[model samples]
Target: MRGHPVTAMHPDHYESPAGLYLHIPFCVAKCGYCAFTSYPCGNAPPPDYLVALRQQAERLARHPMVREQRFATLFVGGGTPTVYGGAELGGLIRECLTLFNFDPEPEVTVEANPNSVELAKLAALREAGVNRLSIGVQSFSDRLLRGIDRSHSRAEALAAVAAARSAGFANLNLDLIYGLPEQSLADWRETIAVALAQNPEHLALYGLSVEEGTPFHRRSEQGGLALPDEETVQEMEDFAYGQLATAGLPRYEISNFARAGRSSRHNENYWHNGNYLGLGAAAVSCLGHLRFRQVPEPERFVRLINDGAPPFIEMEALPPAAAFRETVIMALRMLEGIAVAELAARFGVTPQDYYGKTFVRLQAQGLLAVEDGFLRLTARALPVANQVLAELV
Candidate 1:
């Protein structure tokens, strides 16, 4: 069973960058539709959180496997990493650099929300060697922002982009959300237009999913949430594909668009099933066949680290076959899809060997296609890609 824990490491794995991910759990406030592991901390994280993080990083750095690896990318993400002052976040990155072996030109990225960022802070981050900025600008509509309980306004989002450029960040990514309650197709189109005016290097567009425990989910249960109809939502996605491509930002993945040479290397490593080390509360890591996550509660995580104990709350191992299956699924997320022969050579198993029947079935159904040497979803499956990919899993 996929859920059963195993202990063997796969012989062959991804030949891509080893990335590092640091999670910050504090946020100004939770979004109505957010389900991520985050807490509502007023302005910044508790003083002890960074201490615990530093302790955990120092402990992980001494492991034989970790010490031998050189990281190619580092991403500081969270509820909002910008909540910490630029100097504080930069200090954390500088410490990680000394503790870990990073590539000469590693891509260092930090996630921020417009409301929590300012020019001085951004400049400090740039000075600390952060080369990339990913700002959460869900929409440029004050009405939409309020509807989702977002703290930032349209003006703040625009200012954030200008500030990032002024701070000397050449690589930047902006996130936008669609299918919000009471959002019309016109509204989505306007948001995309506003985002394009910033000319960011990358754009991550996501459709809203109301998960359990989110305010949106409860509102939905009570039949109070108003969302665009399915057809309208599909049209919005199609429009974005054409619009962004026309703007020289082509779709590389289902939810991501980027200018040439600006795709997120950290996220690409993930899509390629490469190894990464994660730190901080609720952070997840995948090494060889071992996968685990830190304790979700920030307080408990800090206690564990302070007490010199592992903070992991969940751990699982993936057998080779299971790992290969996962690689295919994650690869399918990229528009380029999977290189059939290359993966087969690397894993010593063809897609046919593991999923021949499923492949034939989906291919016959027009949801998948093998073109040239790659196996990818068909154009017909792009809109319903999630459903099509789930069938393989």
Candidate 2:
């Protein structure tokens, strides 16, 4: 009787091998640019949080089909995954692995902030089987770091890579941001140069977008903060996109680049519309056409999970039409673009029937091209990608 409910949730819905995303919603100091749900450093999660986490996983495993499923990728991200220090983190990782079936060579990634990286801790994570590190080095300039409220120093961010290398982590990705309030094109070039000099396996470059409700947004609305004009921002992206591609880290997606074989498998799961399950407060999970997310408030999430539930605000089962639209939306985000056959299989509709008009219009505008069974956005249309995507939506 206890196992009956797990079987009824329908394992066929998660037909594809799933990916696991463990959100560590704890941070040292919140960055001005961040909007993720995370508690501050001093406010660590309650000590027994792991027991609740294990409970949730245990429940998931009780589901008949889920019991046998293995994850293709495992991503540990969040409010600075290293904020709790190594011992706590190691326990969480071990518990997760013990609870779920993992791929033979799952791409294991942990997001780290330079401020929290100690050589010993990094080595511990490595020894505990973390093969990839995604370091947040928002800027190499101390001036920009301070302006953005980043807790790490320029030296610390720089030294993190060296430290990771010393600890034997080769699959490293650096995160950089552009379009600062007082940054110049030359400064951006220098930033890019410094990042390239590190010879990272992958890099992610994000334009500074002040989301509504963020401190940056409020200040900008009050006219106290100045942002670069749209034209300047576009030019900045164009410069970086071209420069990075030329430097051999060609843009795989709009803002992400990888050196040869180092693309983030976890992120690719997102843009490619693959199956992924998220844990931790406010983390979202997508299985088949059903999407669910934990309540963003950490305490609330813990309470719900403690009550023997998934801690989500709601479980929304997307209709086939909605799912088709989403597939088109996410697929267009990739440089490899959407495959006709995959879309057809997922949506039960012909790509031509579903997106014929938008495809023709985009192609006539020289912004996209449809090849044998695939449709991809051209480099020219990438900066104005939203405009192109809106037509299909």
Candidate 3:
């Protein structure tokens, strides 16, 4: 059931975010595999996008969640957060943290492209309270990188990390992708080695999926691509998982891993159903019970917020049952699975009551088990998570 059209939630009913997320929707160029609403080399965005972001943050600050609680996690991800540069970007970020009441030691994170990470901009952000950086080092091999149309060279990524370290930014993260066309299991190994060599506090490794409307998706549809076979893809994933775990960054989620205390607390807020407000174009927010979408056009966002109103494109507040379903799907992404007692505590029903049949069926296949009253997926389930999550859906 849809509730009121409120953008902010009362913290007493909703789970307060240990973290916050701001969607920086500008990219220098969109990757072949990316379907997010990012335009590279397209239009010169107005300086007012930053103002609108601050408006969104300040608007939500009036809510009980922002007024009463402090954020433990803060992630500003994008098309490319670094595209905006240092002073301009830093000022906007500072405005947001103050509005949201984020903790001083919050895990502040921003997504960066290897091409975007320079010494000057990197240092500016560190001074502005950005403690973590997530750079897109999608592939180290120039051949594969060109195949994906990533903007950075392997050397640039390496140099960026060095620059970050020299700038006194120790909590660096590298994001990589596997399962590209013509990439061997050995190729995955080399990429992993290069990333681990950096000794980043966090790592995010994603399996390649050809999302609809993306350049990669179009290429696959036209038979212009040749993805690795499923067996080899599985083998690649398995090898990377084991490799990262051994390299001091263990797997924390199906597609992400980190060293101790670096498991992306901002994302963990999402996994645990923590409420967060998304700012900027195409940014999404789930606060209180209302889930809302913002306008995707940069110009439109500027115009709307300038009009003294948040330009929410869509919104939905969940009923208790729907919220329960959402919580199940989100929490299930963790290897820890869903906590049975916790689910019952929140929803007033056991896991067996809401999703008993699916759980029992998956358990019979040795893909799931209930241990200590928590439902968890086995390692085997991870490899076929799409299929497993489908059962729950």
Candidate 4:
């Protein structure tokens, strides 16, 4: 099946977003291990890019689907949103709230790098109605941080948290990465200890994956990288889960842990197959049944929008079977899993019927089980979830 064209968008065709995502593709410096669609902009973001962002926002607001829907959450993510300066970023956010209908108490989040955030910036974002902050503190170990080319030092990471607290931002998330070159178990433990001491409401712990085109990938291919062995990495993951749970932030997803009521609503929307509209360069939007991504280059995106053309570089209308497969894959990432009856109702086929022998075989191997009307991975399967999801897909 093919997705409908962008021209086919209508009020009735809208699958209302649970949230909105605005991507700021500019950063002061790109990290060696980063593969996201972000570029370096020294000192501050280009003024022209901000103007283009506004244009994109205006154009999106004019869409029938956007005009008719009220978003429940908003996430400003980036190369580093704080790089745009708090006042400028605040104005852009204010414009969005004015242009769209949002829930009275929407969960507004912005991603910040420890090196970029300051007390003044935090205050501006708070004044702009941002209630949540996801700060990238990658590691508290200065040595490990320098190895990964992180701009922030240990002191900066700690100070960022203090500043956020001082600015009256109570709901905070800290992002950490493990399995980096020269990152030992002790190093990870200390990082976790420092992060927990900050008392963030949420945490996202990710294992390092050296993506192609990243500097880390080249280092690995040439045998210059010294990443921990798989066993050590697994130990680190286990330690993190245990520590965070003890800290009262239980694991809510494979890579995320949160205190009660603090889970990321925007990300949960994605996990549950809820629709969202993304704006700005390199943003991806899934509206109705179509998935599309805007042009990645900032200049190209701005130029195309100025030309009155859709900036999308790729799009796909998901087939029913493909959609069902995706729904299962995403939902299974959560600890609660997916309801069997609900899946059957939506897709017109039960897991047993759709997956046939693969489903049954996984169950027999103790990797999957049907319990409490939901299909879920067993504890043993969580570590090898990729292999299990591969079979289903």
Report clash pairs, candidate 4. 3-317
- Write down the lDDT of every candidate, Cα atoms only: 0.88, 0.78, 0.79, 0.88
lDDT of 4 by residue, 227-283 (tens): 999999999999999999998999988899999999999999898787889998989
Per-residue lDDT of model 2, residues 1-393, tens digit only = 011111122224435578888887878887776777776755354655556665676777666746777787888988788876677777677667778888777788889999788898888888778899999997888888888888898899888999999989999999999888777777787888898999888999998988877778888888976667777777778887887888889888878999898998888878877777887778888876678888887677678778876587779987766666667778788888888667656555655566666666778999877777787888788878999888766
Q: What TM-score do all the candidates reach, one by one?
A: 0.96, 0.92, 0.92, 0.95
lDDT, candidate 1, 280-382, per-residue tens:
9999999877898889999999999989999998899877667877888898999889888767666766675567677778889999988898888888898
> What global local distance difference test value does model 1 have?
0.88
lDDT of 2: 0.78
Which one wins on TM-score? Answer: 1
Cα RMSD, model 2: 5.6
Report how far residue 107 has shifted in candidate 4, in Å.
0.8
Tell me which residue pairs clash in candidate 3: 18-72, 18-73, 19-73
What C-alpha lDDT, on a 0 to 100 scale, does residue 68 get in candidate 1? 81
Candidate 1: where are CA atoms >4 Å away?
A: 1-13
The TM-score between candidate 4 and the true structure equals: 0.95
As for TM-score, the candidate ahead, 1 or 2, is: 1
